[model samples]
Target: MSKPLEITNLYKRFGGLIAVNDVSFKLQPGEVVGLLGPNGSGKTTVLNMISGALPCDGGSVRIGSTDITKMKPHRVAKNGVARTFQLVRPLPTLSVAENVQLSLAFGKKRHWGREARTLAEEKLAFVGLEGRGDERVGNLTYIDQKRMEMARALASEPELLLLDEWLAGLNPSELRIGIDLVKNLQGQGMTVLLVEHIMEAVRALCSRCVVMSAGEKIAEGPSAEVLREPAVIKAYLGDDHA
Candidate 1:
């Protein structure tokens, strides 16, 4: 079942540099929300904290009614939270199916052997990677690798999915395909928190947006309206543009 994600007072620091400061946001069940900001705006850092890839200096992350602030990455995955990295991460040595099978084995349902492979294939098909399961990850094109990563994330059967620039580096036609893939997830009632710089994809996929700048939230509202905020404009294009 789909679940809501609540991030409260999330704080992160790297020595003297504060990467995130008291950031808070919520993803209601089945809602697609965009987390928008410029580079180094702590958008990815927030995702890391929520996914347990990084430890929070202060704050809490909760999915549904369960607190996951201190959980490790695998624990977080088991709790129905899965994410794709800003950089595509795949085990090049493994076949596409094996990669997703590994994720399925570690997922909430913990399917193994043939069961895992079957479910992995299903996810692969869901991400438009059908019948490419036996192909080596290293041989797949860049966009295909991205699709495989999404398939691997889906193998976990997550309630909440976090995508970090999953649409980056795609051509116009590929971008449309990528946007449609995310739309398919939304149609399936999956809660999504997307960190993207692609305004077109954001406008097409997100109903609402939360804008962050220099580790702080500067704006939040309907996607169209929030993008019109001067603070958001400044955050993206600087003072002169605003």
Candidate 2:
């Protein structure tokens, strides 16, 4: 099978700031890959390029067999890519079910009516938000709100899911739950590209991880081994981690 995503010579710049610099990688079908970096290492910029939230200044963003480098963000979603952002901005006025319904309406139409309802319900359940779909999403707890965002993404019936800090602001237990949710999604054959600062969560979920610094990849390989590489340690972890 072909890879779920391939990014080659990717670059993005914000005026004088070089956010993502010539980054490149491939994510295989059914794989969970981690993108690790500090605050300005351009991890999210890479996501923006790959997800079409921001256009890349150079290189290509290919999902499966199609090159979607210059496609609009909405078109990118229609092309089998869905993403959850770090902020988890739920529609304050919309019920959880309605939020997910909007995602379904915008998807590739793999299901509808009862079938769509069933799929949406299943997604909420997968994120551990079962039976709460009727509630206004703004009323949920912070973690639950993030789960709502996740449920919305899953409702897209996506082949690839881009997760930005999927476990960032949670408590220890919430982090565990989030990790389990991601693992369950992976088990269902959804390819995942996770961008996160949580080392433990990344190590736990990612089969392979790519680390970056100053907008370029510094090290990449098996999660545990890569995080421990001397160069990776020095570049990312610095003296304390060493």
Candidate 3:
């Protein structure tokens, strides 16, 4: 059964610097929640903690009733969490199909050999890569690489998908395609936690938004309402913006 993601009082520290401080939020099943803030606001830190890419110094993360705060990244993936990075990290030496195949092999339910290849193709098609699976990832354009990343993440069939600044650096047309792809994922019942600096995308895709400042959650609620909050406006655009 699918479960809601519950994060409570999570914290992270890098030496003397507190990267994430007592942040807490819940993502109900099938919800697309945007995590928005300025650079260094701990948005990605929160995602890292939930996905087990970084250990939390304090607090807990739960998926339904299971505590996943300290799970290894693979274990976290097995428990139905998957994520993409702000910088696309596809295996550059491998074909696009091969990258997706690797994800399928290591995903929640592992596939092997030919089965993995077939499934990888299906996933590539899902992300609009369709017949381009044979091309090496290094040869692809930036937006196509992003699509490959999404295909690999979806190969895991995760219950909760974390997207970290996936729309960064795209031109207008690419941005529109990216937004539609995210909506398509949501339409297929995937729960998402999106970390994006693009407010338009956040407004278009997220039903709710969480705003952070200096490692703390300062505001959260409906997307439009939260974005207009005095604290949130101040954090993003400065007091002058407010």
Write model 3 residue lDDT over 1-242, tens digit each, in one string. Answer: 45799999999999999989989999998899999999999999999999999999999999988899999999999999999999999788899999998889888999989999889999989888999989988889999999999999999989999999999999999999999999998887889999999888998999999999999999999999998899998998788889
Model 2 TM-score on a 0 to 1 scale: 0.94
Residue pairs with backbone atoms closer than 3 Å in model 1 (clashes): none
Q: Which residue pairs in model 3 clash with each other?
A: none
Q: Which numbered prediction scores highest in lDDT against the true structure?
A: 1
lDDT for residue 70 in candidate 2, whole number 0-100: 100
Expressed as tens digits, the lDDT of each residue in 1-242 for candidate 2 is 22479999999889998888899999999999999877788888998888888999999999878999999888888888999998887888988987887789887565667767777788898888899888997689989998989999988878889999978899999998889989898888889999988888987889999988999998889999988888777776577776
Each model's lDDT: 0.93, 0.87, 0.93
Residue 236 lDDT, candidate 2, scale 0-100: 66
Better of 2 and 3 by TM-score: 3
What ranking emerges by lDDT with the best candidate at the front? 1, 3, 2
Q: List the candidates ranked by TM-score, beginning with the highest.
A: 1, 3, 2
> In model 3, which range of ten residues has the least summed lDDT?
1-10
Worst lDDT 10-window in candidate 1: 109-118
